[model samples]
Target: MNTLKWIKRILMALLLIIFLLLMAGFVFERISRSIAEKIKPDGQFAEVENHKMHYLQQGKGGPTVVFETAFDPAGHLQWYHIQQNLPKSYTTFSYDRSGILWSERGANPKTGEKMAEELHTLLEKSKAPKPYILVGHSFGGMLTRFFVQKYPKDVAGVILVDSQYPADEKYLSPQLYKMVNQGLPGGFLKFANTFGAARLMFKNMFPENNQYQYQNSVMPALLYKSADATLEEQDHMKSVKTEAAAINTFGSVPLYVITAGDKTKYDSFIKDQKIKNEMLGAWDKMQKDLLNLSTDSKQIIAEKSGHYINQDQPEVIEKAVNDMVEKVSVQ
Candidate 1:
């Protein structure tokens, strides 16, 4: 009888502890969300269809430069530094795709084609001028290509920064490929973010030397949105190849393919040296192929940079955009 009573008491204590923890998590989540809201959002929203798309615009006059983000959840924030430094004569804009950052969740099947179409509408509604220069980084490169293929006359030039090729997966080993393509379960991320656990985990993930507080403040909001968007895009990866096939050539539109020079950095992620070399070679070949999209295209190597050339060597990207603008002006 005493043993049974003791067991009941212990179970009750455990339950009470869990209930308190849950309450604490709820309070923490509210606090974290309040902090996130205090941080200023980068841009305003343009009504596209029934949803709102967030975008930041700066400068005026010259050919408008539209910046597309990588697979990052933070969206427009990725181009904050570069956009700020752009020449005042040239207008620059950066925007978050639907289901990212401040943008409302979009309709189902968020494929590349759908994304590009939405962007077209958003630009038109926002009154951004025509004959625009499009710049895409990483996965965004594919979207930019689709945009040009769909609306060739609207675009003045293309800049691909460490962009993803349709054949990019072929270079990776089966394990590495799976790891890269597979995303975390969206529901789990949502749950963590709702209770502020995701924010806590991310806060610890960054090193002490990393002083980027902007990212930390925005991570909680990005946690679920980024994961869901990434998974949705991964589901439609096959469509990218179809889009690439349709655009056989970019005509005379000036194209710039910026390849990262530091392939060895990926060695840490890939243990085997030979496989790393093979992956680097495949990436280089694929980037070269991107140049074939236009007769006037050229490839520049960001000598000291890795995948995030804008972060590592902002000068390279800035110079490339400036050069493209000058070239477009002459034509």
Candidate 2:
């Protein structure tokens, strides 16, 4: 009877500790979220299918440049420098997709086509000047393909910045691909974030630079809905690849492909030199293949940069967009 009583007491104490930790985490999460809302940068919101989507727009007038972001929750951060430096005479727009950053979570099965449609609706509602010069990075490249294919009329030209190759899976080892896609499960991530684990882990990781500080400030909150959204995107990538492959060419549409030229960037992810070399070769081929999308297309290598050409070499993107804008303006 004494032994049994001791075991029972220990179990009860453990349960109580867990409950208290959960409550504390929940409280901290709520407080952080509230504070983040108050201090974060202001962005316009649009209702898309009963959920709010957040967006930032700079400059004004015709030939709008619409930026599509990669897998990160803070999507707008990808284009901050370029968007700010673009000519004020031309409009530039970037947004957090559904369930990312300030945007509210939406319905499930967030496929590429569905997202493209949502973007169209957002554009219609926001009244952003249309027939845009579309710019996409990483996963956003896949989205840009869907957008251009579904709403070809809304696109004047395209600029792919170190974009995801639909066939990337074939090049990368299974381990690397899984590592890249299968980040902590969305449910666990949300739970962890809600319980303040994510916040606690990354609180000190924020950059000191004021320009980018606010961008990183919102990350702890991002792992909630955005993690699920990212997983959904990864789960449905096969369909995305199939849909993107349907477009054999863009005909006369002006296209610019900015390839990240640093082959050594993958060295960290891949150990075997032989496999890394093969992957690098495949990447180069895939980038060059993007040029075939349009006869008017061109490719510029960001030799100093890795996957993030915008951050490493913003001038390459700015010059490409400016040149595309001029080309489209004449036509």
Candidate 1: segments with Cα more than 4 A from true spot: 1-23, 169-176, 184-188, 204-216, 219-227
In the predicted model 1, the residue pairs found to clash are none
10 residues in a row with least lDDT, candidate 1: 204-213
In the range 1-331, model 1's lDDT, one tens digit per residue, is: 9999999999999999988887898898787666656656777788887888888888877688999987766678778778878888878888988877678877746777778888888888777777789999988887887898789989999999998886656566786567556655667766776666766665632223344455555655555455566556655766765665566678888999999999676866778877777778878888998898899999999999888887788899999999999999898
Residue-level lDDT for 162 in candidate 1: 90
lDDT (tens digit, per residue) of candidate 2 on 253-274:
8999999998788877778888
What are the lDDT scores of the predictions, listed in order? 0.79, 0.79
**182, model 2: CA deviation in Å?**
4.6
- TM-score list, all predictions: 0.86, 0.86
Cand. 2 Cα-lDDT: 0.79
